[model samples]
Target: SAVISQKPSRDICQRGTSLTIQCQVDSQVTMMFWYRQQPGQSLTLIATANQGSEATYESGFVIDKFPISRPNLTFSTLTVSNMSPEDSSIYLCSVARTRGEGFSTEAFFGQGTRLTVV
Candidate 1:
């Protein structure tokens, strides 16, 4: 099992500003992903960060808007670039635990960074 921690539990930022959130895992993980939860909305996967390759972003999310960096196992960062009021949401970091044969188990999520853009 792995434990995930996120920085800046909550914050308020001005529009057009950007915020970088950090995620740390207690153990090395093979699958690390970033998600976003809009107000009163379900979680949306932003991207999956590969250990040594560029992150694979979801359909709606672009690399320029949500750049991700995974330098190594157990660590990653997600930056919400050029924030807007619509970008206000809870950004969560998730890591999936794997079982035998590379199958994934339940995913663990961090406390999340609640950013409110003004």
Candidate 2:
């Protein structure tokens, strides 16, 4: 199991400003993922960050809008650029670890960063 921590649990920002959320893991992980949960909506995967390579973003998300950085195995950051009211949502950091051979992995999530744009 891995322990995850996220900073700035909540924030209120004016429209057009950007916010960067940080994710830290207690143990090294091969892959780290970022997600967004809009109000009243299910979690939507934003991107996957792999150390030493460029982050792979999901459909409907662009690198310019949601830039991700995975500097190492245990640390990553996601920056929401050019904020808008539509961007207000809970941003989550997640990592998965395999339970055992032939078994599915268990995902661990950080206490999400809630952002509100006004």
Candidate 3:
């Protein structure tokens, strides 16, 4: 299993601003994923970042707004751009660790960053 450490656990930003969240894994990981969780809502996958490659953003997400950077196997960053009240949410970083047979893996998550855009 990997231990993920995320920074700026919570913050309140002004409208039209941006926040950059960083994630660091104790061990190397093949893939890293970023997610957003609105109040009383389930997790929404924002993007998947792989080391040495461009991150793939999910539908309703765009790089221009949610840019991601994975510089190496154990580090990645997610930036929420042009913030607004509607963007208030908790952002999380996660990585999956597979063991033994088929598609069986345990995912580890960081202590999410709660952003309140006003």
Give the per-residue lDDT of model 2 (tens digit) for 1-118.
8899998899999998899999999999999999999999999999999999999999999999999999999999999999999999999999998887878889999999999999
Q: Which portions of model 2 show Cα errors greater than 4 Å?
A: none
Q: lDDT by residue for model 3 over 15-71, one digit each (tens)? A: 999999999999998899999999999999999998998999899999999999999
Q: Comparing candidate 1 with candidate 3, which one achieves the higher TM-score?
A: 3
Candidates sorted on lDDT, descending: 2, 3, 1
Give each model's whole-structure lDDT. Answer: 0.94, 0.96, 0.95
The TM-score obtained by model 3 is 0.97
Between candidates 1 and 2, the one scoring higher on TM-score is 2
**Error at 14, model 2, angstroms:** 0.9
Q: Residue 36 lDDT in model 1? A: 97
Kindly indicate the candidate among 2 and 3 with the higher lDDT: 2
Q: What TM-score, over all chains together, does every model reach?
A: 0.94, 0.97, 0.97
Candidates arranged by TM-score, highest first: 2, 3, 1
Which candidate number would show the highest TM-score if scored against the true structure? 2
- Best-matching candidate per lDDT: 2
